[model samples]
Target: MKILCGSAGWTDKTLIACKRFYPADCRTAEARLRFYASQFPLVEVDSSYYGMPSAANSALWVDRTPADFTFDIKAFRLLTGHQTVRESLPKDIAMAIPETGKKNLYYRDVPAEVLDELWRSYREALEPLRNAGKLGAVLFQFAPWLMCGPKGNAHVEECADRMQEYTVAVEFRNESWLNDRHAFDTLELLRRRKLVHVIIDAPETVTNRAHTLWQVTNPELAFVRLHGRDAEKWNATGAPTAAGRFDYDYSDNELAQISGPIRDVSRRTAKTHVIFNNCREDQGQRNARTLMKILGR
Candidate 1:
């Protein structure tokens, strides 16, 4: 698996605010990125949460990295949140909730127009990344409530279509996808389309755990995220505390636990990607380095 680390060059506030991976001190983004690339070949940028970046920003990122280094960009929040459904919901569902509320379908049941607008916005935001050759897959990560169903498959298809402008990779939070034929069908469709499948790894015993790991069943590129195993507070409002708090480093033995599956997939796939989403202050940074050491990259 190609090891990729999370954000670096965080401030002290970011450290205390995040607490998981923050150091007492760190350097600038460019300096830290250069240092990191010297160890790992790729990075997964999670900072593009608000929207697409300006062209200048993407250029700056490219210039900072060596020609051989690469970056994986996460999709916009609007895409991740299923913002298209915010239209058309009844007034109760629409204005009934607060913007900051963690409601599943904030303003769902709205018209398809909202979805269309969202899809358009999604494309616009990804353009800069694509133009810079820094764009990876449009990580279509769904919330746990987004269970697998006919509707989801349609949306998945549409996601791939919308991604014609770039690479599209999907990650499922709902486990109903595990046994259902729909899951296999969806996987087959993704394989046929040559879109990447993002395998996820998280503490499965927790309430609403996202995924066990990025299942590298196919030979396409693999994208995996290791969200720490904070099984207790997973469902509470304070989840991000644990989510971005605990350290879940893979010991040398545990790294062996994953090597075979990765190699098995690599036997067929062109390239594989493993992302450490351990958002705890510096755990992601630390774990990423450990993974690179283990992988001898």
Candidate 2:
């Protein structure tokens, strides 16, 4: 089994601003990506979740990274049932929306034709990565309110169907999906749909937090995203930036403790992707490197 360890995204304001991970010469986007790939075999594209990814940028990623390197892209906010801003949408698509004075748009707010176009464009943009065999998986991280129920199940199935051509990973933020009552059903659902179950490591003390489930639904791939255990930030009120929410760093003992389950899950899948989402400054980069050493990858 192959275990690929890396960070959620290469470009983070604090990661670059801290001047700890990237070299002094690695100022350009291309340079940073190239340098990151040299250190790790995998990475997750976090920016795509905020806005539509461009085909040109996708092609540039393929050209910049090595052949064996791969990227797991986060699905667009609209596709994942997240509240997206008008500016995040394409200019033409945003114009299509009637002047309803709505600043935020959800999946239901978008017209059928416009949504179809979005799905098509999203798929087309990632074609370069898929064609070059650099695509890892399209991550569909459902919102916390998406509880385990019929409607939620249907939405999950729909997302899998939409990205049927590519490898899809599902991450549920709600605890209901993996609680004692519905854990079995949730795993079964993913297994039946051939969707990779994303195992997350997050603050256990927080309400509605998804507990770390070591179960692997897809034999082809198992995804693990480590969001450091900082209950205060995770449970904070008001709007919290990505960095502030996932700012805690993993200690050596913490990494060693989790390595066992990670190794066990890797054995059952063809490949396992372990992504560090504790993206405060260079925390993820440093933690991922340490985990790689622990796993002897």
lDDT of 2 by residue, 129-234 (tens): 9999999999999988888999999999888888999999999988999999999999999999999999999988886677778999999999999998988887
What's model 2's overall lDDT?
Answer: 0.92
Model 1 C-alpha RMSD to native: 5.5
lDDT per residue for candidate 1 within 228-264, as digits (tens), equals 6655545546554434434465566766676666565
By TM-score, how accurate is candidate 1? Answer: 0.75
- Where is model 2 more than 4 Å wrong at Cα? 239-242
Relative to the true structure, candidate 2 reaches a TM of 0.97
Q: Which 10-residue window in model 2 sums to the lowest lDDT?
A: 235-244
lDDT, candidate 2, at 286: 96
